[model samples]
Target: MGRAGRKTVLFDEDKPHNRVTQESHGFITQDGVKPSDFKKRARTDVQKYPSVSIKEKRVEIIEKSGGVFRIQTKEGKELYGSM
Candidate 1:
């Protein structure tokens, strides 16, 4: 996503792992990689981008109206933007 181009992007902080460990499938190169390994790699790639920022907080509420969206984060941040 490009900065100041898109209307909104919300990232709900989640571990993304349903269980402690899992097996990979269908990928030819890394067929049976560990779940943690994938997570770490993905996080690293995201961190490499200058436009991507990471946040850790549950989104309490999100509402949209009149081409604008408002999000209330659990970290006590209220944000408004256009779409």
Candidate 2:
């Protein structure tokens, strides 16, 4: 979305897949980077774009209609987006 100059919202909850698991490997310049650090760097990069925003809440449901997507969060907030 950043590449296309479109505003974007990223939902991250740090689920099980993001739990501490030592070091992450197999990326070109980021091999052996700590998982937490890697995630921080990724978030930082995304934040570099003023059009990008991050949401730390878990999504409860997502529905698509009329070429738009409506997402509901566990906190009872709803978000809508269209491509």
Identify the candidate with maximal lDDT: 2
lDDT of 1 by residue, 26-58 (tens): 756666887667667767766666666666767
Q: Write the per-residue lDDT of candidate 2 for residues 5-79, one digit (tens) a residue.
A: 798999998784846678788877987788888998999899889888899989999999999999999999999
Best by TM-score: 2
- Candidate 2 backbone collisions, by pair: none
Give the per-residue Cα lDDT of candidate 2 at 61: 97
Instruction: Show model 1 residue runs off by greater than 4 Å.
Output: 2-14, 25-31
Candidate 2 ranges with C-alpha deviation above 4 Å: none
Which run of 10 residues does model 2 get worst, by summed lDDT? 14-23
Error of 2 at 44 (Å): 0.9
Worst 10 residues of 1 by lDDT: 1-10
